[model samples]
Structures are given as C-alpha cells and as structure tokens.
Target: MSVPPRLSMATLPSAAGAGMRAPRIDPAALDIGIVHLGIGAFHRAHQAVYTEDALAAAGESDWGICGVTQRSAHVRDQLVPQDGLYTVLQRGTGAREPRLVGSVRQVLATTEDDVVARLADPAVRVVTLTVTEKGYRLDRHGEPDLRDAGVRADLAGHAGAGHRPRTVVGTLVSALARRRAGHGRGLSLVSCDNLPGNGSVLRKLVTGFCAALPAPGGEDLAAWVAREVSFPSTVVDRMVPTTRSGDRDEIARTFGVTDAAVVVAEPFRQWVVQDDFAAGRPAWDRAGALLTADVTPYEAVKLRLLNAAHSLLAYTGALAGHETIAAAVADPELAAAAAALMVHDASPTLRPPAGLELSGYCDAVLRRFANPALGHRTLQVAADGSLKLPIRVLGTVRDRLAAGTEPTWAALAVAAWMVLLVRGRTDDDRVLAVEDPMLGHLRTQLGRLCDRPRPHDAARIVAVLLGVTEIFGDDLPAHPVFRDLLTAHVARLLTPTPRRPSRSAGS
Candidate 1:
C-alpha cells in the first residue's frame, strides 16, 4: 500500500502557495547549541516558540536546538521527514493562528549516542529538560529513589561498562562525565518542568545520584559537576493538549499540507526563569520571557493557584460528567468551585510577586480554562495523580492548615479523587482507568475498603487514603482539623443529592 505524502522541505514552496507560513530563518543554516530532553508537545509549543522568537530578535543562527526524545521516537518520526520543522496552531476564541517553528535543527532518540555527544559538546552551552515530575525518579521526601532499578544500575557504573543510561539523572551524569573527561567548559541546565524550585531539586538529585555511584572517580566527578554545571529553575505555562487524529486532519484541510508534527495549544502562555547561567545563554528575555533573580514568587503562585486549581477541576469535572476543561468550567457549579479553590484555598497560601493581583490572576486562569478551542481534557490532566497531588494540591492544603485555615476547597478536591476511585468510572459513564504509577497499590488498598459492607463509607475511605504516606505523607492524617474537614467533604461527596423542584410545580 502507498503511504500518503506529508509536508516536507521539498513541498514547502507548494504549501506556502496555499497560504501556509514558513519559518523566516533557514533551518539548514542554523547550528545546534542547546540540547533539549523530552521533546513533547509542551516543549514544542512553549520553549521552542520562545527560542525561535529569541533567535529572530537577535538575528543569530547558532542557538538552534537538538531535541532528544526520552522514551519513544514518536516526535522524531514526525519531525525528521520534515527536516526538523513543525507547525504551532494557537487556538483562541477569535481564530486559529498557525505558524511554522524552526528552532529545532535536529532530533534524536534517547538511546542514540548523539544525545550524550551533544551534551558533551563544548559549543553546547545550555541543556533544557521537560521530562515531567516522575522523570526525576524522586521518592516521597523529594530525594532520588536509590531503589529504582535504573538508578541502581546507573549507580553501579553501568555507563562505564558500555551500557546506555536508563534514567534522566543517569543520562545527565554520563553526559557530564564525558564532558569532564574532555575538559569541556561549564554549561547551564535549565529545568522547565512544573515542579517548584526545579533547578535546585535537579541539582540535588544529580549530585546524590553521583554520590551513590560505585565507580572510581565518582567523588571527583561529583565535585567537578558541582563546580561546572548550573541548574536554573523555571516556571512554564501553556495549555497544549495531546494532539489527536482530528487535529492532523484539520491541519491538512486548513494548510493544504499534511503536517505530521503539528502541535495545537491555547493562546495563553507564560515563562518565568531565574536569570542564572554558568555560561552565556540565549536572550530569552528579548522574546518576552520573564527573567528574574528570584523566580520563587512566580513559581509559588503558578503551582499553588493555577496548578492546584487545575487538579481540583480535573477530578471534580470528571466526576461531574465534563470531558474538556472548557466544558467543565462552563458548568456554573464547577466553575464556582474552581474559583473558590483558587481564591480561598490556594491564594492565601501564596505570597505572590509584588503588584501581582491574586484576584485578576484567578480570573485569568478561569478564562484560560474555558478556551473551547484548546479541547484540554480533564482525564489528561487528571492522570498521574500520585505524582501530581503532592505539588499541586497537598502543598496548598498543608499551608492552609498551618495557617489555621479550614481548607474546605482543598478537602473537596481530595474527596473528589477518592470518589472517582471508588466509582471506577467518570460521571460521563466512561471507564476511569486511573493512569498513575501506583495504580496497583491504589487498587489493592481501595479494594480492601470496597470489599467491606459499607464500601462507599466516606470516613473509612478518607482515613485509608490519607494514611498512605506515599501520597498524603505522615503529618496530614495526624492533624485533626484537616482529617475532620476531609471526612466531612468526602461524606458530602458520597451522599446523593435531592432533585430540584420543577418551575411548573411552583407555578
């Protein structure tokens, strides 16, 4: 069977005639000076766009990106044929704006030696990562999980024995080791993940990973890494939903070209970065990126208010039978709950940057969530609850309780997750296949309670789940106020509601 043709460099001229915009810079003329790991849609729509704009503003061609796919070759498959070109479709209430992004000059799979070589290159002064929360292999205490099989293997000096590094930490260690051996200069490692203090956290993890290595010169290598590398924390925000088949069809229809590497995102975007680098770096600030000496204030506001509210709505919205965030926020009850979560529960916990209006920020977040064209699904955001809850919801809950606040909205968010787990399906009647790493443990624990006579007992469910230290930690369950509020909220969630009175009957 003949495969359909996709948009490639050879077809750019023809595609441009059909009203598609191409990259302003010559992609072939650009050189890769930055290596990015976990090159997913978010990276494409967020950092890549920023980098492209930055390059254009500076009129420089040396800072192009080499994107490394950590797990699969899905991105590489789509981008290689197109000569590292892709489309970004910014969807808003008014119209869909599509443009070609050209910052990425090369793509490589994680297993390829080119990834390490790129990292070891002296010319590559910057490395960026979007490897997500779980990619760090952090344990409950926010430290590297030494027991992880990959961690154990990497620490056992597998890389020295010609074995490929399996984890991100291991890969970094290997790359840095190669660079150190080659007498390469220092470089900046920018982390664009959603975690708070991401740079410091990654530094600790990498150093600790090195400390555990049984290989010779481990201590020296760790010392060299401490002296050489700089990890700068950053907060990245954008609503880039997972691309679907329909998106591909729409791109073909609208652009008159079949773009396999097209990414769609909401119009809202923000990037706040700590202006710290070991070597020279791109002028990202020129592209409207906020570079600050302290990104903590921005990071805290985003994580607690925006991210926590997102999690609150995701679970609750799923329980309320809403598929997309826009659809969910359209429901007055859910929208009100989300607002309450942000203003009452999350806002008080935040020490926002000076002149940053908490109320306006909350309003803007809700408006972004209601962008119908983005089609950001509740289930997609709801996935990886075990990994997400600690940063997104639990932190706010802890802060509120510490401040002698009730945390009613935070409790409701937790209760909603429990309710979804017990129900085993969304309110929309779709099977809720919990996409968490601890799925097995969650099922076993919930199963024990569910097998009892009163399986849906809210008190019992909350007690058991809260006791799971991996998710809730040891301190929360001990707090009587938090426990009681959580129990009350869970009970309310389990209870059936009374039907509303009909207008006809009242008349």
Candidate 2:
C-alpha cells in the first residue's frame, strides 16, 4: 500500500471526479467575512456545508469562514495542512457522493492573537459558534459562571490587564471590546449550539460577563454590545457522529486522497435561524436554511421533540449496552420509549412550528436516529446529561406536570441517566462512559446506592438525585407525583431483568 496524496487546494481539482462534488466556488476569490469559533466536525459537517452551498447558490464571495479551533490544535493542524479543505461523506444517501468543501479559507488557534484580530476586523460581520453546552460556563440560570476558573482568568485579562483571555465568553467579551475600539461596526453573533433560547442566553451571558467586569469599563462595553450586537437563536439538526478512521479510509479509497478532517454525516440536515442579524449576512435560506423572525417556536419544537428523544435513547441505550443510537432505536422497548417521549410527553408541551405536522416530525426524528451509517454513540449523546436534560427533557417534564399529567417517558429518561450515574455499566458488564460536569455532585448524592444495595433503596436514591436543585430546581422535588414516578422508574431500571416500560399513572 502506498501513501495517498494529501487533500489540498492544489490537489482539490483532481480529488473531485466520480462519486464526488468539487468546490463549486473558487476558494481564492472569497473573503473572510465570517469567523467561526469552534471548527470541530459538527461545524464542518453542518454550518460550513451550509455556507458553502449558500456561496454557490447565491454567488456570494464575501462570507468565507476563518475557522478557529477552541480546544486543541488538532483541527487547526489537519485543516491548515490541507489548506482548509475537507471532505463531507454524506452517508445514508445511497448515492455516496462526498463533497469537498472549500468555504473555510483558513484556520486559527484560540491562543493566536490573530483570532482577536480577526474578530475585530470590520469585514467580519458575523461570528458563529458551535461550542457545546459546557463551553458556555453557564450557571443553572443560564448566566455566566463568574467563579469559573476560565471565566475568572479571562476576566482578569480583560481590557489589557496582562492576561490572555481564556474562556469563550471572556474571549468574546475581550474581542468585542477591541471591536468597540476599532471599526465600531454592528455584528451578528449566531449561536449554532443546541442551547435553549441560545440567542437570548448568549446575550445574558455577555451582559453577565460585562457586569462582572471592573466597574465603568464593563458598563461602557455592555452598553455598546447592547446597541451594536445581535445574538440570534437557531435550531440546528444534523446527525454527525465522530469521524472514525474507517470514514477516512473510505474517503481515501473513493476520492483517492487523504483527508484527516473528513466529516461523516447523515443526509438529513435542517437549520432554522432567527433573521435578526446586526449586519449583512449570508443567504442561508437559499441553501435550505429556514431564516425567520422568531426561532422560539422552532427551537421549542426541536428541543422537546428531537433532542428530548435523543437524550432519552442515549441513556437507556448505554444502559442496555447498545453502542450506537441506531442500535438503541432497534430495541423494541427503547424505541417505544423514545417515540413516547416525543409523541406522548414532549409534543403536548410544544406548538408545532408553522407548517410542521407533529406526527410526521416525530416519525422523521426517530427515522433519523435509526440510520446505522451515522454511528452516533450513545455515550457521546449521554455525556453532559446535567446540561442537556434541562434543555431537552426537563422542560417537557415541567410542562406535563403542570398540565396535570404524568410525564412517564421523560421521567424514565431521567431515571436512565441516574441509573447510568450510579451503576456506570450495563447488565452485560460493558462500561458505560457517561461524562458530566456535575458528575461528582451526582455521585456524592447517589453514593447511598453503595450503602444500601437492597432493592427497596430506590426511594432514597431518587430523593438525593432529585434534590439536585441545579438540575431539578426547587419545584420538581416537591411534587409527590413526579417523585413517585421517578422512584418507580429507577427501581425497575435497577433490576437485572430489563422489561418494557409500563405507562405512567396518568396521561
């Protein structure tokens, strides 16, 4: 076996032959008008693809992306060597045509001063971020965690106090201050993360960051941000699993090129964005993006229906020793619970986004989950359940409980998370690696399971977990009906024999 030629702009034209679509827009003619904060596979597979398609369709040459890798230098390394060109293997389509995306013109490390320079650039009117939930360093109320070490470090560095900004919130604030001083143009801050009310939440975090800053400078900057910046909430749906080596191997075999930054995504993709840009922006609507005045209805629909069911299956699937989401949906009991979550528990809490029929949307969400080619790991989805459940499952639980009904499937999802938290493995002895920022807190409360291993100990276990006010809040634990259902679900899920879940006490 010989080494394949690396995929780069110079080699791009050759890489696109049969079974592949080359870049439709010339990468050289484009300008970097957008700076994307997180250049991970999700951004590459979802937003970057949309931008590339938009550029091709709308004939826009000014919206090219300057990708910034937030965590490690790995993404920068892969993309920089390839001249910011990567492959998207759109799986589950049957046609198997990989797309060579060229909208990302360059890559930068978060530590690089050029990141701030790029942010302050007047030409860069839009900044998009897909940094995951934990990246926000938010408190339970969705405000910036001022005590967070990264936030603190970044704050101390603010306004040139001799410290480089650390956290994304801090970094963004610092960059905004620079932008305030130079260019002084209005900008659009679009959040592509799976956060509830992401735009408003981001505004709160920014204002919170501003408030935490030292006195007058903070007030002045916050005022400027309030006037000049717009954070638009969005509902982004796509199943992009961690790109494995086999995906790279397939890309190499089919395209005859080596792309370390290849992203394997399911064919189904949707983006519903709020059309509230502070400056001129991409015509994403031209590329199948739904740009509207309000993203709330759409956000609620996606969060409660699609995302809620996804988290439910992740926890239950991990406990059942099913590796991927597809395997989880294949299970008769888990599949039913997932559908019940969307149809029975969550749907009642949401108004169908205009033109979206609830029945079809629910079916489509599960169908997407059952795609074997996606390889979305249960544990990957299950990670950060502490952050995700509040956004995905708890809202439905609260709404259902308020509506005088039992949120059976939602409670079961929460119970599965608790079970995974306590046991950390399946009955088959496969380790379920579920990560959470609040793991130690949950483990401390759930330690009672080790004390009383009896079957009847489910009540105490449920109490401690529910008492997590940060997650459940003050109202949920006080409700007898909700508590009883969780206790019942936890007890049954704890048993060695897995059984089909019976419906809760009420609708």
Candidate 3:
C-alpha cells in the first residue's frame, strides 16, 4: 500500500477529496498583506478562517497571510511543504466538510529577515498575533518586563545592522523603527491574545519598549509610535483541539491527501475586534466578525463565564481522571460546579454585554465544551495556569472581592490548579503532567513537598503559590478569606478519591 501525495496546488486538483472545498481565490496570485505572529493551531482554525471568508465575500485577495512561527520552525515545516494549504475540519453541528484554507500564502521562521521586511512593508498594513500570554514577556503589572535579559539584550542589539532581536516585542519595535524610516505609513498592530484590554496592553508594551531606548532616540520613537500605530484589542472565541495522528490518518484515507497541518475545530467561531485601525483592515465584519468601538463588554462576558469556567473544568476534570472536556463537564458534580461558577460567581462580576442573555450564554458555553467530537483535552486547557488563570478567572475574583464577597467557585478553580501543581497526580494515581512557565518557581517555593505529596501541607501550598505576586498580586495572598478558601479546597482536592466508573469522551 502506497501513501497519497502531500496536499498542495498540484495534488489538490487531482486528489479525490470527498466534499472538499478549496479557497475561492487563486492563492498564488494573492499578494501578502497581513503578517501573523505565533502561527499556532488556534490562529489557523479561527482568524485564518475569518480572513478567507472576508477575502471570498469581498472578492479581494490582498489580505493573504504570511505566518511567522515565533517559538520554532515546526509550523513553517508543516505549512511550507504543502504551499500553505491545510485542511480545517469543523467537527460539530452544521459543520461544512473539510476545506483547504489558502489564506496563509507563506510561512516563515522568526529568524528569517523576511518577517522584519514584511512588517516594514507598506503593502502590509496589519500585524496580528495569537502568541499565547507568556509571549508578551510581561511583568506582574501587565507591563513589559525590562528586567528580562532577553528584553535588555534585544533593546541593545536592535540598533545594529542585520540584528534579529530574540523577543516578540523586540522584533515589533525594531520593525516599527524601520517602518518609520521607510514608509512613514500608519499600521494596525492587533493583539488577538486572551487579555483584557489587550490592545492597550500591547500599546503599553510597544511604547514602554520605545521609552527603554536610550534618550533622544527613545523619545523620538515614542512620538512616532503615538502617531503611526493602532493597537486594537480583540475577543476571539473558538475551541480547536490538538490534532491527533488518527485525525491526519483519517484525512489521508477520506480526502486522499497527506496533510501535516490539519486542524479540528468546533463549528462555532467568533471574533469581536476593537475598531481602531490606523490603516484599513479586512472586511471581517462581512464574515460574522464584530468590528466595534469597544470590545470590553464582549471580552468580559467571554472571559468570566466561558474562559473562567473552562479553567475550573480543566483542573477539576483532569484531577477526576477525565481525559476530555466533554467527559469533565458530563460529571454531575463538575457540571453543577461549572454552572454555579458561571452564573453565581463570574456573571455577577461582569457588566453584561448587550443582547447577550446571561443564562443562555452560560448554557451555550457548557454545550460547546460538551462537544465530544471536538475532544478538547482537560490537560490541554489546564496548561499554563500561571498565565491563563490571571486573564480568565482572577479578574472575576478581584471584582467579587471588590463587591465585598468571597469568590468560592473561583477559589475552588484556583485551588484545583494549586493541587495540580503541588500534588502532581490524578485521584486514581495517574501522573498528570504539569506544564506551566512558572513550574520552576512553583517547585522552588513548594520545596520538598513536590516529592512527597500531602493534604496537610495545603495551608503552606496556598500561602506560597499566592505569594508569587505575578499571578495573584499582594492583595489576594493577604486576603484572609481568599487564603482560607484556597487552603480548604486544596486540602480537599489533595485527599485520596475512590475510583469511579469510567466515562468515555462521548459520554
């Protein structure tokens, strides 16, 4: 038995792709107009889809993306071979059959100078990023951490000819300097990451970078940035799971083409963007995206209800030995907790966005999580708790605290995260792999207890982790009620559990 040819322009026409849909425009002819940093699965499954729809609807091809991989060349390796063609399988109700997404016209490693050139390119008006939270290299204050060696090195090295700075902010500031020298044209720098006021956060980082520059030059760059760049916040919603090898094999069998960059997503997708572009952008509005003056209202609703609840489910479900989110939410206890967290704790924190009924919205979020076909992993969502919890749930905790209330459900979520960090295994004794940027700091603080897990140490665990002010800040760790709740939940979670009946992902 021979393997099918790789999916590409040449193989696409002849391939027996069942109900396969190709990009509407001639991809080769489309000029690159947008440069996306952190070309991960989430970006491909969300923004790329919306961009293609915008292109198709408007019959414009100028917005083809040149995806730059920030961390590694893996995405470039997967995409470049296939000419930037990948299959997107929408997995739930009313899902359109697998389609070849061609919006990604080119793929490049961050090391490639083409990234800087493209960023400075006059034709390219917008720069979008799906780089996860830690990519920003932010300090506890949600500002660029100048103390970072990478940042300091990049700032120093950026002045040299043919120098490639190591960090994302360094690269952007360098490109903006070049753009100012050459085109002097305005551009939109959109932050599509999960952060409240992300646009402003990005703006601060960029300007802060400019300020970090030595004297006259720094002041000059800051002025130019003020006049030339627009950082737009966005609220992007989509649940895209890590593609299994089985998914690629099935694609090869069903579509008769080998694809290294296949992505599986739920049918529902959304993008609510702040309409503050310096240069014009894609007509994403035509493709079900909301281009609005303020994204805060929508962003808050999603973060508090959907995203916060997701963290809870991931932490609790993973501990309960559930492999997938669907199974996690199906547990009666976990489901009830998730519902109460959303409606009782998180919802009250938000100034509800218009036209979004709180009850239905929360219900819809659980339904989306319960989509067995998507198979979003409990551990996958649980990864990077240090970064995610701050953006997703901590704000709600803060708000509730401000309103003179104890955020019980939110504390449980945080405590579950603490247990995952301190205990290091599931209830049935499966070694749950803990992956977080702060893993080093967490372990160092937790001391010998990392080796010997103990529920009795819950008080110490809560005390130490909360002391990592970057995640919790000074107030949360000092809050007696918060400390008590976290200690209680951590102790409870750390206690041994009786083995329950096995639950399949579909159940």
- State every prediction's TM-score relative to the real structure: 0.94, 0.96, 0.98
RMSD of each: 3.7, 3.7, 1.3
lDDT of 1 by residue, 1-507 (tens): 433457777777766777777776777788989999999999999999999888888888889999999988888998999888888887886554678888898899987645777888888999999998989998876677987988888777645756788889888888898988896688988999988899999998888888777656778888898898999999999999988788888778777778899999887789998988998788899999999999999999998888888888888877666777777788778789989999988888778999999999999999988887778888888888888888888888898888888998888888787777666565434576667777778768877664421324777788778889988898998998888887787776656555332111012
Which parts of model 3 are misplaced by more than 4 Å? 16-18
The candidate, 1 or 3, that scores higher on lDDT is 3
Runs of candidate 1 exceeding 4 Å displacement = 1-4, 94-96, 112-114, 451-456, 497-507
Decreasing TM-score order of the candidates? 3, 2, 1
User: What Cα-based lDDT does every candidate model obtain?
Assistant: 0.83, 0.87, 0.89
What is candidate 3's TM-score against the reference?
0.98
Worst 10 residues of 1 by lDDT: 498-507
Error of 1 at 6 (Å): 1.7
Per-residue C-alpha lDDT of model 2 across residues 283-401, encoded as one tens digit per residue: 89999999889888988988898898999999998888788888889888889999999999988888876688998999988888888877888888999999898889898999899
Candidate 3 clashes between residue pairs 3 or more apart in a chain or in different chains:
none
